[model samples]
Target: MSLTLEQRLDTLPAGAEVAWCGQQYVTAGQLRADVATLAGWLAAHPARHWALCLDDAYAFTVALLACGMAGCVAVLPGHRRPAGLEEQAPYIEALLVDGDWSSAVLSFPVCHWQAVMAAPLSAAPTTPWPAPLSVLMFTSGSTGVPQAILKQERELLAEVEIQAGLWADALAGAVILATVSQQHIYGLLFRILLPLRLGLPLAAATCTTPEQLQAAVRGLMRPWALISSPAFLEHLDPDLSCPGARWLVSSGGPLSASGAALSQRCLGLSPVELYGSSETGGIAWRQQHGSDWMLLPGLTLSVDAAETWWLTSPFLPAGQRWALSDRLVWQENGFRLLGRADRVIKLAEKRISLDEVERRLRAVPWIAEAAVVPLEIGGRRCLGAVLIPSAEGWRLHATLGEGRLLLQLRQALRPWLEPVALPRRLRCLSAMPVNSQGKRPYAVLKELFDVAIEC
Candidate 1:
């Protein structure tokens, strides 16, 4: 019987199970039942848009799918804070939170996953319609406040073609152990949608640690595709070297050249890098160690006068020359990426803005002027800030010093840069790292940062 998504999921094979990080497993039947139960709770509130703020992947799946089934749109905001909630409240009518429910943050019904799963699957709504503009994935606010990227069912089809076909070399019987999160588009494609749509095996849990990865590999039947980022690859335990897989996939930031070489030597699979973002979804992809890509067979990219990326994609919504922030160098064969047009620095596998870092430092009150520059140390890039305070420079600088200052700054930077890129060296200076328009010149900052560290 040729069936739709709901029908296919409602009757998946009994034996096929999602290995939950090698700790446990959940069958297709259980997943369907969980979604079905939540579908009932969702039916209670109509025309309500809900958000999933919890860290758990499986709970997010159930909540999202249940909302899709009930014809209610779901807004996936990046940062779930009072500010984030305030900005996105206009799009959604309510919020959906898991276990440690925050009554202070939410004004809507806060039901546990257990409560949701126990609830009956009210009246089955009309089968999947034109997506109902259900999901609103926020653009990475690296440039500014996140913008909502509305997605329909067609996104599932788009992801399958771009990501699932290229990186995921999983055969008919093979499974995929996703290291990325499904809440984000990239993760949603590899972890949840592709597995559900194309019938590839997926790990139930989001594996982070190497021990967890080893356990996941031992448990799964096949060498799974590890969906991951450069950050995870760099810090991976050098001792634990058993990641047997068909291949691996990485995105979000550039995979370090050294790390890629190490991964191939250790894990036996060089990651396939994807060049795209939350705004335009995935555009082009290539093998980590290999050169160039097949391109997205049908698409072509061009540059405008100010030198911006203009894309023409068949998979994209009815559009042509969709302008995006990422700039590119169009080579004869494939393409080479520059970086984000914004002032953000894609360093140490994290996306952070130099300006944003400066802004945070000035808010300390004592610091009269502050500027941040991206500097490289030990073949890895790190943040370097030059501060001019009201008090004597040496007094303030000596108090924190370079070593102790790094430890102090890291605490403040947890909200900005990922662990790896926090500054190792601090310098006291009279000025910040910016031009007249308050613009940061990439070349100038890189040179000063390098010189200061060497000094």
Candidate 2:
């Protein structure tokens, strides 16, 4: 039998390849040494919770394992912006970063990851992580605030086991390449833990562009599996050929039918789409667009009188039933998702709360009232904002013109929102379109952006 991740960490041979960093491969020996050294540094620190914001996947894996080894809770904030980190400062004691962040103004002590990795090796032996290890992750809540979700080590391991059991055969002898960030749960599982648990080599850097992905695949000369998102898969050039790819997994949002067909033509494989949320681990998966989603092994689904979905799984805390905002219809073989019952939407594979965007917009001094709606622009989904500006805002808009006024609003929102969550188009309206029931309908709000004079 193959060794589990914990056993492999302790028993893998020194020369075994672990990851591809830059032009060369990082070996098991170096990974162990670096992890040990960093773990020692972390152990010596007084912090109990360390936030990981590294861009390099290799550095992120090293920091993550070291945190586990050192008995600290790892917090992934999903974004590396100073403002985002500041919002998480109350929960985290220190920050672990890889790249140069000299200009970022932060309130917490920063740990330069490269310097610690350069330190002399420690002789400490790797041991099994303590039971019930936890990680803190933040996701946008329906109430327009970032909600913290705690995931136990066992839960993550169970998810890894389920995925490995289902797809390991197809992915055997294949290296992993990804176009997603490790900060999210899906990326953390597929790009990092799954490969580590399966002993498959993973690329240390994320391939953000089609050219980068092509180059990485061509250089590998071996079968590869792509861990990607709907946003990245949608943008892939149909003519771009990736010859050695064997498996492709898409998550974070629903993949359009056209996007799935495009992946089949470009990568020679239809993407296996995963459906779930941070609050719940993976729920179901399907390969064909519009097909019913098959539940993963060991999960039960229940629906309430109002059609809200509830999930009970071993991966959840204590196997308790968790409520979900999605409504589903049961089919003979599986379930079909109707749609979400909340205002939250996925933009560029990032979970965004429309309420949160409106909240931030209303907080701006020049904005009196704000409404946000999802818009599809140039084959991509994004946000559009309709603002009922204050007197001062209207004055500025008249003086600065719509272009400059929109720029100012975007700049004001940069500190609170991710780049992908920011509104791509803006319009200033005298009054919000509301129905007789005093509720703003989504159709009316979306129609405001249909005019040609959008800012």
Candidate 3:
């Protein structure tokens, strides 16, 4: 039997540790009190839509749960920039933030953490568990504009239940630590929902760098489960001690066989990779030694004539089937993911749109024309950009030298693009590569980057 969010909350003893902030332990009682207090404030203000933009993991978690209890839709944006916030301002009533943004003025009102904490606590609202409240997740948009994927409380709760059962024995009595941000779907599910629902202690700070991660779990005596991504797992220091971890889980992108083997040698456990998307909760997962993925319980899978995978899961809306962007081959137990059917590719575990990167490059004032392609380098995928320089670009290149000019343009584009979307391999061309038929030749354009690209 599955437990509802409300029931799970009730199961945790008030004194049970819920989170560890540095050396301090935050109890379940404290978390509940905070949630109740925030929910009360949200109820009194009564905003139909609220944007959560907190950098602190614990604060973000409280705001998320409070909004659900108050029955207001919570909008989580991938970027915290002013322009990005402005794009969501029309859809949200106000922004909830724990970060400093006092200098910049924004369209919507901002609600700081201090204000929320001072509000009086009310009895936990009568709203039932697994309430009808909705959460809108905006993707990082490696391809183009961020797309919103709507999720209901039930979908989140159900996913937690399914994952809990799948790893019940492995996760029993283990504390949860993570390197991923709670802002994304995988992080939310693995780091927040799973632990909270199962009454496990969670770490407050996300381990962004390997050193931080090593430090966090250094002296911990309790068994731990790490929820991380392929990019982070690829770089773990084998010399470091990760003594208490029972298992390390990777998602957000496929973990290469070598990465998995390296993680096992260094960390003493091979990562369990989950293959899924924000659109469809979690489809399948596999360990490093396995060639095929095994479907989680309660998921139905099919393939169309075009080889695109289709899914109907408990987390998805009833009677609605989702068509995935990846092509797959069906097996009796699960399926084998072949590759993506779309132009989107994963770079450093983040889905990047080649087309979107090209568009942003073309929009750069110094670039007259741009073409972007994905290239594998040193066992990882990265983007390569070929550009036709505008008049301004030519002048800068001649004056500042190629390296300096490239650095300047890269910095300028950071505001409009993500770090992953910025091309690490760039080349400036005299003209577009074309054939006798007057059509651009993709083979030549791709080969230019593989060989020597003339600036």
Compare the candidates by TM-score and give the number of the best one.
2
- Shift of residue 21 alpha carbon in model 2, Å: 1.5
Against the true structure, candidate 3 has what lDDT? 0.78
RMSD of each: 4.3, 2.0, 2.9
Residue 288's lDDT within candidate 2 is 90
- Which candidate's lDDT is highest? 2
Candidate 2, residues 1-455, lDDT tens digits: the string is 44444566767678878898888889888898888788778888899899998889889888888888888899999987888789888999999888777577688888887776676756345566654457899999899999999998888888988999999998998989999999989999999989888778889989999999999988898899999999888888989999988899999998988889889999999999999999898999999998899999999898878777889997898848989888788999899888888988887778999999999999999899999989987877888998999999999989998778888888999989989888888889888888999999879888878862344
Model 1 lDDT tens row, 168-274: 44434556676666767778766676677656656757778777777777876455677787777777776766655776778878877776886686678777788
- TM per model? 0.80, 0.95, 0.90
lDDT (10s digit) by residue, model 3, range 296-373: 889988777876668899999878998888887777766777788777788888777777778778888878998887
Question: What is the clash count of model 3?
Answer: 2
- Of 1 and 2, the candidate ahead on lDDT is 2
**Alpha-carbon deviation at 372 in model 1, angstroms:** 2.6
Give candidate 3's error at residue 173 in angstroms: 1.1
Write down the lDDT that model 1 would get. 0.65
